[model samples]
Target chain A: AQTVTQSQPEMSVQEAETVTLSCTYDTSESDYYLFWYKQPPSRQMILVIRQEAYKQQNATENRFSVNFQKAAKSFSLKISDSQLGDAAMYFCAYRANRDDKIIFGKGTRLHILP
Target chain B: DTAVSQTPKYLVTQMGNDKSIKCEQNLGHDTMYWYKQDSKKFLKIMFSYNNKELIINETVPNRFSPKSPDKAHLNLHINSLELGDSAVYFCASSHSPGLAPDTDTQYFGPGTRLTVL
Candidate 1:
């Protein structure tokens, strides 16, 4: 069973600044995937980015990027140039290769300050 | 063009009631999944189906059931729903199990907000 952990309950960042949300997972599988999802007040689940375990390079999507450390099992999301739209409850998720289940972390509430 | 969509964006019902949420995807994906986001914002996978075949059924209660009649549609049916069943349910879709570099990102639907009173 794979478990994702987001130690931070909440984080705040000034607009245009950068913020890093920590995430780590417990998985014995060698091949897997990691993802970051954002849920706003609308209750819509939005995909921020994803990283493949076999790939050494991290994944980047516009202002969002990940620091993926396969050995340490760390997959942290970095939100650069944070904006009001980026303020949402972010979740970390993990899925084993070819497996359908995607386990999510507790969550981290993100606040963007003007 | 929405790749994934779920009907009944909001559902409010009493306890012990029965309800269903329907999901559809136009991405030509073969896999669909059901996820529950509780009040605390903890998202968990409850069920998954691949081409109408049950792939993953987590430790969810028996009252919660998932139905996949075809490749592009998956529905969730809850019988005798309880207060704990109140949560935002999200449906997602991805391409086949293993294809290409596995470019499927699992596009998600807007989600259905279920409130059990």
Candidate 2:
């Protein structure tokens, strides 16, 4: 079974600054996908960024980018120029190509400091 | 146009009762999934279906059942609900390429909040 772990339970970033949330996973499969999802107070889950294990290039979605270390099993999310709208709970997830089931972390509460 | 939606955004029921949550997706995807988000905000996959056929069934209790009449809809019915069952249920869908296993993004619904009193 694959499991995702996010070390930080809470993270805060000053406005216009950068923040990084750490995530690690345990999986024996070589082909998989890592994702970061954001859920606001409305409880709507939004996809932030996704990284494919086969691709060495890290995924970048505008201000959101990821530092994926395949060897270390680390997939951290970095948010640059953080704004107030970025305040939400973020989750790290892992899914195998052959399996549709996704393993998600407990999630990290993000606070944007004005 | 709404892509995926779940009815009864919030539900409160007493213990040992039965309830159902309806979900529908208009993305034309062939696969649908049911997930539960606990109070601590831990999201876990409970079940998934492909064209109204059971694809994946997790270690969830038998009290919880999922029924899919078609590829576009998946409804969850919980019997004798318990306090521990109080959580938010999310419906998602995905479709893969023909004859190959490819990574497809899963679109999630707004989620239904179920509270067991």
Candidate 3:
């Protein structure tokens, strides 16, 4: 079974600064997808960024980027030029090519200091 | 337009009561899923349907049932609900199956907050 783990339960960063939320997963499959989702107080789950296991270039979406290290099974999300809107409960997720369910980590609460 | 939506944004009921949450997607997606977010905020998949066919059914209790009448709708019915069942239920939809690339993004609904007293 594949399991996603977010080591940091809570993270705080000042506005205009940068913060990284660490995540790791245990999986045997080499071909899979990793995702970072943000759930704000509205409880809407929004996709921040995603990375394919076969791609080594990593994935960047605006101020959000993922540092995906396949061999290390580590996928961390970096929020650059952080804003107050970046505050939310961030979740790290994993999905194998053959699996239908997406396994999610415990989640890390991000707090932006204005 | 609302890509994905769920009805009864908030639900409050007593134990042993039966309740239902409806989900619909207009994204023309072939796959739909139901997830539960517990009090501790752990999101877990309960069921998934693809093209109106049952695809993934997690190890959820038998009291919970998922009905998909069409490719765009997936409804969840909980029978004899218990206090433990009090949690926020989410509906999501995707365009392709699990193996397809560029289709892994699942759009979520506003979520139905169910509180079993």
Candidate 4:
């Protein structure tokens, strides 16, 4: 079984600033995937970014990026130039390669301050 | 166009009542999944189907049933809903397993909020 952990329950960032959400997982599998999802007030789950465990290079999607340390079992999400829309409940997820299921961590509520 | 969609964005019903939430994906993906987000915002996979075949069934209560009529549609039916069942349900889809590169990314739908009174 795999488990994802988000140590922070809540986080706040000033608009236009940057914020990093920490995530760690327990998995013995060599091939897997890590993902960060955002659920806004609308309750819609949106994919922020993903990182492949086999790849050492981090994944960056526009203002969103990840710091993936495979050996440390850590995958953190970084939001640059944080916008009001970035305020949401962020969840860290883990999935084994070719596995149909994904395990999610308890979300971290992100607050954007003006 | 919406890649994934769920019907009845909001559902409110009395306890012991039966309800179903429908999900559809137009992404042409072969795998679909149902996830439950409890009040604490912890999301967990409940069931997964690939091409209408059951792939994964978590240790969820038997009252919670998932049905996939085709590769693009997966629906959830809850019997005798309980207060604890009041939570958000999200549907997602992805490509076939082991395809790597692109198969791992799952696209989610706008969750259906189920409120049991």
Best by DockQ: 4
Clashing pairs in 2: none
Residue pairs in collision within model 3: none
Checking candidate 1 for backbone clashes, the offending pairs are none
User: Total clashing residue pairs per candidate?
Assistant: 0, 0, 0, 0
lDDT string for model 1 (A1-114, tens) is 678899999999999999999999998999888999898888788888988898999999999999999889999999999999999999898888757778889999999999
- Estimate, for each residue in B1-117, the C-alpha lDDT of model 1 and write its tens digit: 988999999999999999999999998888899988888888888888888999889899999889998999999999999988989999998876566455446778999999999
Residue-level lDDT tens digits of model 3 in A1-114: 799999899999999999999999999998888999999999999988988898999899999998988889999999999999999999999988777678899999999999
lDDT of 2 by residue, A36-112 (tens): 99999999998898888999999999999999999999999999999999999999999988888888999999999
User: In model 1, where do residues sit more than 4 Å from their true spots?
Assistant: none
Q: After superposition, how far is residue A83 of candidate 3 from its true place, in Å?
A: 0.2
What residue runs in model 4 are displaced by over 4 Å at the alpha carbon? none
Q: What class would a CAPRI assessor give candidate 4's docking? A: high
Per-residue error (Å), model 2, residue A97: 0.4
Better of 3 and 4 by TM-score: 3
Identify the superior model by TM-score, candidate 2 or candidate 3.
3
Question: Predicted candidate 1: what Cα RMSD to the true structure?
Answer: 1.4
Interface RMSD of each: 1.4, 1.1, 0.9, 0.9
Share of the reference A-B contacts seen in candidate 2: 0.59
lDDT by residue (A1-114, candidate 4, tens digit) is 689999999999999999999999999899998999999998888889988888889999999999999888999999999999999999999989858788899989999999
